[model samples]
Target: MRTAIRLALPLVAAAAALSLTACGDEDASSDGGSGETAADEGGTDADTDAESQDSGQDGEGGSGDGAEAGTDGSAAPSVDDLMGNWFVDPADPGRSHRIVVEGPDEVSFIESLEAEGDLCNRGVYADGTLTFAPEDCLQQGAEPWPDRSATLVLNEDGTLHVTWESGLEEDYTFSESEWGTVA
Candidate 1:
């Protein structure tokens, strides 16, 4: 019995360590999911409220060249230009559900499993980064939810590359048959 306990003790410790590591990975940062911190998640709803106030400022509508003027006044691509409804091909695993991008600042996706309700709150990219937090507590059940954040880069060839810290990354290219303006 003494030898059995000795071996079990190490096994128990190893199991505990692994569990802790998994939990840590799940809640580490926005890189884990929407790339938001605890403080950002807490204030995301407020940020949404604040964004409403600035929606009017985004009225300067034009085709997004994905380029902007840097602080040095040099021409650089801005993620803001990519803000618009992006119809993600449902058939593609790399590309999930269709996404309605309000701007680089906000994004919304209709619930894929269930289409009977409002859009499930997700994340958005501003300054070329996307961050999402759980906004609707009622809609999201008691699952371990994490914030997600990622940077968006639009290539001149019309491909979108998303790099996230959560080890989840994808690259999407527009399909001519499925590409069009969102109505």
Candidate 2:
């Protein structure tokens, strides 16, 4: 049980950071690419009031490149189609998570720890999931890196779908600020 919490803490922190940062910068733009506009119809902002109260946990804040509409003028999203900043809202209310990917292969799972700073679980993507190990979460004097993994799927509406091994799942939308240069 301890191990589970250890592994899950970072994710919660990441969510906290995401929600906090996203609310403050609704007009932020991504560089070298069109930015993702904040969705106002999904009732996401309903939690903004509650989320704003706990915005101190500053995690890696970012947005994603604008999704290109498919040839048919309809954007059908796929796991392979997501290659930039994506925000994750966990099943548990009020927790927002974000991930940045260099491509389908390189990814960073970022979470903020109160005193330990940012805990980034780095790994390669395969079969639509990210697998992490001790080395993946490596940072000087960091806590024992608990094994963590999450599956990512893309929704037809261009949101990134996420499911963790622990049965925690949520739908994440593209953020307005892109992280790294897509390759």
Candidate 3:
């Protein structure tokens, strides 16, 4: 049962992502795997999800030691807070990638270099942090990560701090688009 839940989590995550989010810009194509400006995805404050409503009331209690806390000292980045184009800091468009994390599980990452499996083990976000599953799993059209996962956190400075399981740590910043400056 545990194994099944872990395997099915991505699907559940995907569904939740689809149901709770509606994003796109006039120029942004709504194609699967297409990276775009999630912040500009066309929704108002009224689009806020129910999950966010409750988090505002009690999410701050989970803050551990006040490191990387949000505006209200909440440590984890809410799914809505993560909506945007996260490009590699220092702005390298060729080497690493630009990832749009629409939800804890639904991510659209584009690597200009076409590197395969670079993010296969970026970890699966659940219950706050990204975690590695003990059981091996495979993503459609991607490589398999057997015992793979990593650490991802949103800093108070609005930067994404990621330390992959492979000992690679990097920071990602928000941008309106690939060619656009940080927004």
Better of 1 and 3 by TM-score: 3
Q: Comparing candidate 2 with candidate 3, which one achieves the higher lDDT?
A: 2
Model 2 stretches with alpha carbons more than 4 Å out: 1-80, 89-95, 113-118, 138-147, 179-183
Please provide, for model 3 over 107-176, each residue's C-alpha lDDT reduced to its tens digit, 9 standing for 90 to 100: 4444323322223323346544556443322222222222254455666555666555655454566654
Task: Write one digit per residue (lDDT tens) for candidate 1, span 1-183.
Answer: 554344334334433443444443433323323423322335223222221221222333334454543333423235444444333332331223333454454454432222111233445556556666655211221122232455555543344454455544344333222222223
Candidate 3 displacement at residue 115 in angstroms: 5.6
Off by over 4 Å in 3: 1-74, 114-124, 131-147, 178-183
- Candidate 3 has a TM-score of 0.43
Reference-based lDDT, each prediction: 0.37, 0.45, 0.42
Estimate, for each residue in 22-108, the C-alpha lDDT of model 2 and write its tens digit: 453333321222211122224344224322222221342223234444333533333345555565532222233456665554566
Better of 1 and 3 by lDDT: 3
Error of 3 at 178 (Å): 4.8
- Considering every candidate listed, which one attains the maximal lDDT? 2
Error of 1 at 175 (Å): 7.2
TM-score of each: 0.40, 0.45, 0.43
RMSD of each: 19.6, 16.6, 14.1
Off by over 4 Å in 1: 1-80, 87-95, 109-122, 136-147, 174-183
